[model samples]
Target: MTSKPFNKFRIMMKSLMVCTALLGTTFLAKAQTWHFGPKFDANYSTMKGEGIKNKFSPGFQIGGFAEYNITKHLAIQPELLYSWNSYKKSDDFLTYYVNSGRSAAGNNVNLGTVSVPLLLRYNINNFLSVLAGPQYSYKIYDDEDLIKEGKEAFKNSEVSANFGFQVNLSNVGFYARFNKGLNNINDIDDRYEWKSSHIQVGIAVRIK
Candidate 1:
């Protein structure tokens, strides 16, 4: 079960990467002003669900982005980012696991995802821009010790929306964004729905 699902996910991600590369190449060939750079952010993230606590855990996202200017005030930026997220569940909700011979594991769910967001950026000034976009993510990192994959506890993919404001100064950039999950990630029988969200603050260094 795990083998087939993991293989399919890997193949899909590879295809997505190919498509993104091809699109970026086409944009470059069109004589567009493209800025490529590295980005890294520290995030406060958590999940919302019936049994989950409304608590945030510290994590980070690190990746690169390509910004293509469409006009003086408009641009499109596509980014490939990897997110590491963690959250805690209610102790009452986790007691069941303790009774069932599984370790409580601090009721923590730690996972990692690869996300791609194509943002439409609107420049408000020489030093500021606001961006919003739809994002697709695949869960490639999992803690098997806490959540066994053989049981298929969570969905492998997620769809989300991202909106944010960025400040730019020369080659260095700073931004804050809200990432809201649009689909329920609960895969173990939908009696209760679970979704994730994050607040991210980061810096980007563009190569001119």
Candidate 2:
């Protein structure tokens, strides 16, 4: 890669690290009242746009989170995760026309992302809480094959909203959430805007 793109990547990475460090500092300030642990998430994801196929593509996430209690009924939680997903493109107009002589053999893309979510939690009861937040995600890897086909590559970063409910039992929790993209990731064409959507189901274990 050129120095320009490499510098951009470095800047983005530094920004993300700074944000994580700030969150950790806040957690430490409330160390006596904070709890943290690891989490695992499974995602069924899809995209919507012109000439796009929407399907439930599978993805996985692994990460850690910290919760700081502000009151009996309110808390703030922040998470950092590494996520991976695979999506398929079928019957695309550009694909069909670009490879007129050849057969359509493969059209799968794997994406790796670094995700950060800062959530505000409202405790509805002892066993349940509702969370709403904004998530920041940066693409770390994208399938080169898809990019070579003149397809529009996904944006380097994405911002989205997350709404979910969690059920807690002692130190373990189960959650289900919907992630809705707020910005168009499609830069290839101006006719249609592509947005992402995901269904996330996950389990979290509090170790401290």
Candidate 3:
């Protein structure tokens, strides 16, 4: 009779141990599912022209992004980024100097901007996500040599909207974003416009 009671006790203890082990495994898997990390980006920027040949100007960014999983299909991402943008003047000045009565000056301008973007991300699957959001940018520095003569300053601050898509791996993600400027970049003259629309490719790591 004592042996029968002891055997029942043993069975109960073994079941409890299995339950505890399963719970621990579930917690570990949940912890590994969420993460945050730093990012680096490289991009190209150029002006839109009609009947003008445009060249790609190189740009880059470094930043950090955080992601929270709301479900298997939805997420929220916010990022703080430092971005550099470059633009070049048209060759019309060269044509003016050769054919018309003017001197040609080549102007290649670069602007440094600090940007913060809040994006809403929708996951199509484990490997792909689409993002769109508003971005605010403050001018940190500008190349004076690139500005036209008599201009006090180029456009310095901007607010814009961005849209992009991301490709995600287990712990790493690659993304491409396009920013469309809604504010004038030049603060000196209203007639002189400084706007930006560029495509950036970046890598992200998950920390959590």
**Model 1, stretches more than 4 Å misplaced?**
1-32, 94-106, 144-150
Per-residue lDDT of candidate 1, residues 70-112 (tens digit) = 8999999988877777777666554434432234444666667
Error of 1 at 188 (Å): 1.4
* Residue-level lDDT for 8 in candidate 3: 39
RMSD from true fold, candidate 2: 5.4
Evaluate all candidate structures by whole-model CA lDDT and list the values in order.
Answer: 0.77, 0.76, 0.67
| Model 2, span 39-153: residue lDDT tens | 8889888888754568879988777789988999999998987766566666764653353211342566556678899999999998999999999998876653443444545
Instruction: For model 3, state the Cα shift of residue 61 in Å.
Output: 0.6
Q: What's the candidate order when arranged by decreasing lDDT?
A: 1, 2, 3
- Tens digits of per-residue lDDT, candidate 3, 44-160, equal 877553211256789887666667678888887777676777777665633422332124333665666667788899999988999999999876655534224534345566898
Query: Which pairs in model 1 have colliding backbones?
Result: none
Q: How accurate is candidate 3 locally (lDDT)?
A: 0.67
Q: Global CA lDDT of candidate 1, please? A: 0.77
lDDT of 3 at 132: 95
Top lDDT: which candidate number? 1
Candidate 1, run of 10 with poorest lDDT: 96-105
